[model samples]
Target chain A: MAGDAGSIPELDQKKYDADEQVKIICLGDSAVGKSKLMERFLMDEYRPQQLSTYALTLYKHTATVGNKTVAVDFWDTAGQERFQSMHPSYYHKAHACIMVFDVQRKITYKNLANWYKELREYRPEVPCCVVANKIDADLKVTQRSFNFGKKQGLPFYFVSAADGTNVVKMFREMIKRAVDYKQNPGDFMDEVMQELENFDLEKKEDNSEADEDGLKAESPDLV
Target chain B: MSFEAKRCGVQFSPPSIVLIYEHKETKTIRKRIIPVRNFSKYSDYSMAAERLKNHPRHRDYLEGVSQSQLEKLHIILRDHMQGFSLERSLASFNLDPDEDLNKLDDEELARKKGQMDELFEKNRRHKDDPDFVYDLEMDFSKTTQEKCSWDEESDDGF
Candidate 1:
């Protein structure tokens, strides 16, 4: 393990059993504090997730859902900001989604529709959470209601990664919902995904290696 | 299930490559704003273009688009991010080779240099070409009365 990875905790080797692997993807415009939220949730302090070797880091967060530890892969594709419509693979088989927007930037909040629209295009039924980030910048805004999440009937959160307010609560609830979806999907989307992959595409498969290979093959653009 | 590329454009506010296409199955017109990540004013337009074209997930959707077309959009995005006006950037399309590149700002000069490099690559002849000759030579007509600063011969400079 690298020195920096130590400061960021890892699942205990002795008890690490990824019986249920869940992928939680974060979607937002450029500089919307998506990484900051993930960093804050993973570690005590918010440290910008680095991509020195593996492009963007997929945080392996170990969470307990119903007494069974579930290994969750937190997706924060930092430089993957090329399109308002994200790559479908970004939502491919994703269990849950975190849609974030910078509270200070109104445009980011306005663009949530495009992000959510694209999210539904691929994964129509995944549990999604809408986050109003950077509350520390102006805590007063939290008192106001953002109707995007309410209209869509998705869970909405007011989080501040900087001062660490409501970050834990938001992530914990997201994990629980994702695990619930995995155990008992509300509709046929899960079955369709399984049919498409033709595999269980479930807990036993360790996606770390598969994803690492994918990143390794991704060369510097224009090369 | 398939998308046909109708047109492509650049979005400056968020630095995105907007692709307008029609869903072949649904017959719906859709816009996919592909976000340009980790890009800056100093980012290489061609490289950025290639990166977007070859992005692991994005490449599949961008397959129908042309590389040159994508490069042009990236150039425009880079120019806008560098604070160049739309007119000024568009004006580069019809570059006057005789224009004084020295008078241009650093960003403009760099862009012009990039254009020159691309042009040079297009016209460059290699030894393996059909017209390749080992003893290729040409004679140039001398200027009438031009005496540029570099023309002066002095012992001080090599």
Candidate 2:
């Protein structure tokens, strides 16, 4: 059990009608091999697209959330662009996040605090799963505990994107929590983000319709 | 049971061919995103386009599209992968009909060749084509002479 990470509602964020889409974002230091983990999660059901506009990739996955199976869209980044600081806009419209780090590298683990600091800037209330990736390399680390996730009250998981360890299981739980938090976003969510601004669900064309479909509008040069 | 290709474009970030189409019967517009896998800057655009056009899951949706059009999209994606600027890649497609391809560099020539192939296919009379003429004749003489500059003034590539 992730230990009563909180289900009680406090603030009312934008609520979705049943079976609405969920946008999940993933961020971490560029330790390499996260794609292997994505493959583990997507299996043959996915085709990873390297987006050109930014240092990110969008993946399409379907997960069972409650009775109806809902579509979950993930926006994440990898490669050399990750060596630079990730743009804050990466968190825009994100319902939840899966923060991953290479367990073999203590520094990647330590850097989570810095990442979390920036993450709080935009999303302070979304449910985040602190994932230590590449545990297959060192089995002993799975037995160890990390204070970062515990101190922040975030759920923690030791996963192996290489061996498919807890990858699926961890995502399933994250998806459900994301849906719940999106509807309520109250007490269960960290209260810091609620005060920042109105949970504006603007159907504005500022990439709103495009974000819904992850498809670019017709304006981009298509030569 | 027919579809019209409304628009065609390529997403360079996560390299994929995005097609906007209209379902002929219902008049509903739909988009299909076909991810390009295992391709690099140096990949063969023809092979990649052929594979995608023949892919079972995609072939039906791609039925109305010509192979050369898909090849053009692949070339643009390849340009992006090869780190060429968008302006340069797009310029390669606005081929000058009067320009001599023989004098072009390899990369530029390939792009021009691709355009020529598409044009030729569009005009070629297939034996199975409904209006296929046994001996086709055409008059393509220009009716007017036009002046042109270095192309710095306009976009028509004239």
Kindly provide the TM-score of model 2 when superposed on the true structure, using C-alpha atoms: 0.47
lDDT of 1 at A40: 60
What is candidate 2's lDDT per residue for B48-139, written digit by digit as tens? 99999999988888876777778888999998988899899988876553443334544565565466445344443334557744323221
- After superposition, candidate 2 runs with Cα above 4 Å error: A1-19, A80-83, A189-223, B1-158
| lDDT of each candidate versus the true structure | 0.62, 0.62
User: What is the TM-score of each predicted model, taking all chains together?
Assistant: 0.45, 0.47
lDDT tens string, model 1, B85-138? 998887875545344333554345445544433333343333345764333222
lDDT of 1 by residue, A21-82 (tens): 88788888665667656766776333444553333446777788888988787777645543
Q: In model 1, state the lDDT of residue B95.
A: 47
Could you give me the TM-score of model 1 versus the true structure?
0.45
